[model samples]
Target: MGFTDDGDIAAYRRRRSVEFKHGRIAMLATMGFMTPEIIGHWPGYLSPSMGLKFADVPNGLAALNVVPSLGWTQIVIYFGLIEYSGGFEDYRSGTPGDYAWKALTSDDPEDKRRRLNVDLANGRLAMVAIMAILFQNGVAGTTGPEMWIPAL
Candidate 1:
């Protein structure tokens, strides 16, 4: 954004696009991290060839070390692919985060603007919430609803 003094439309669009992407990821991650604490992880192994069992994975960030090396590579490649799919040309000239997906996005201008605002706000909140959740899970050893009720 400092590249330009004002009217930096490209930077603005790119920033919004990034914010939405991070917001969505954070929302999903928070749910994934907390849901297991409440209802437990998947019933069985997620990767049979690697003998990786989601159900056996520990809660919170500690689970990161349990993933196989190939899984981490796959994750990195997947993210890279998604990022490449949204070419830089689109960010510079066209809609920044508009994947033009048929569902979830709105056609109305007002609704689109509102959704963008809320996405940024929620993303910022989720960024902080995730850190707090991680600290609590890793340090206090509490999760989900149990963190609130001492008797639980």
Candidate 2:
């Protein structure tokens, strides 16, 4: 359901490539993900398709509470790693190339489809992390102290 225009396709290709690369990084980070706090809330900002969702952390936390400690830190680390790894240009540039030649001509439609799938999947995971934080903080407007925060 993405734009088929030349410019749109170009953007999609570039974004897809970056996301494919980022997903690898995320997988590595999550390999030993013990707590929701460590992963940080993503809300799938990088992905184009999926919208945001809550995290799966047992003790729910919210945006305001987690943004400073967990969310911002995770964003910094993710971007930092991406930069150190020399994926900054690919991450920043959002353009597609001869996608047909790359996806269909060389690989099959299924192979090309997996690239988009990764984006969607990564987005979902990020949303879940965000939701976990929001839930812990009672972001739905209920009153509660964040478990990770020192209770007064």
Candidate 3:
């Protein structure tokens, strides 16, 4: 039996497409808010013992410093992977989730399973790396509860 024969490929694609679009929108919105959020707190209010101070660095350098120090590079890397993995093409074609869904529903079940496994593994790795950075910066500790409370 073929892979497409096991299920409705079109329906699966449509459902996956909607999910992908929603996830992309949510991710982009979060990143938009998180960049400034981190910039406001990092190195200024939440600098670790040896962390660079925003005030000590020039404006240009400080802006550059936040990119790597605040885990923004991970966001960059995620988007980069999306683009490289054909997600960008799917988006450009107005089918936001086709790339991944196609891979998951491809004719070769073994290949599909392998791709999904790798994607899952990579996602976990990224999460671990981000958590490690947060811990390294002391953001994971209970010492700064007040710093996390958003001001209205």
C-alpha RMSD of each candidate structure in angstroms:
2.9, 12.7, 12.6
Expressed as tens digits, the lDDT of each residue in 1-152 for candidate 3 is: 35456597565555555555455454444444345444643447334565656544332223455544545667688877866784344434543343646744455767765665555454445555544534544543321223568767
Model-by-model lDDT, in order?
Answer: 0.74, 0.49, 0.50
RMSD of 2: 12.7
Listed in order, each prediction's TM-score against the native is 0.78, 0.33, 0.29
Off by over 4 Å in 1: 1-7, 49-52, 87-90
Deviation in Å, model 1, residue 36 alpha carbon: 1.2
Candidate 3 scores a C-alpha RMSD against the true structure in Å of 12.6
Please give, for residues 14-79, the per-residue lDDT of candidate 1 as tens digits. Answer: 776777778778888887787888887877786899777887678877778888777889999998
Error of 1 at 104 (Å): 3.7
How displaced is residue 64 in candidate 2, in Å?
Answer: 11
Clashes of each: 0, 17, 0
What tens digits encode model 2's per-residue C-alpha lDDT throughout 1-152? 54545566556666666565555555544432334445554454432333324452233333444333555678889988867985444433532222244532235556655655655577558656544544544655422334346767
Decreasing lDDT order of the candidates: 1, 3, 2
Give me candidate 3's TM-score against the actual structure. 0.29
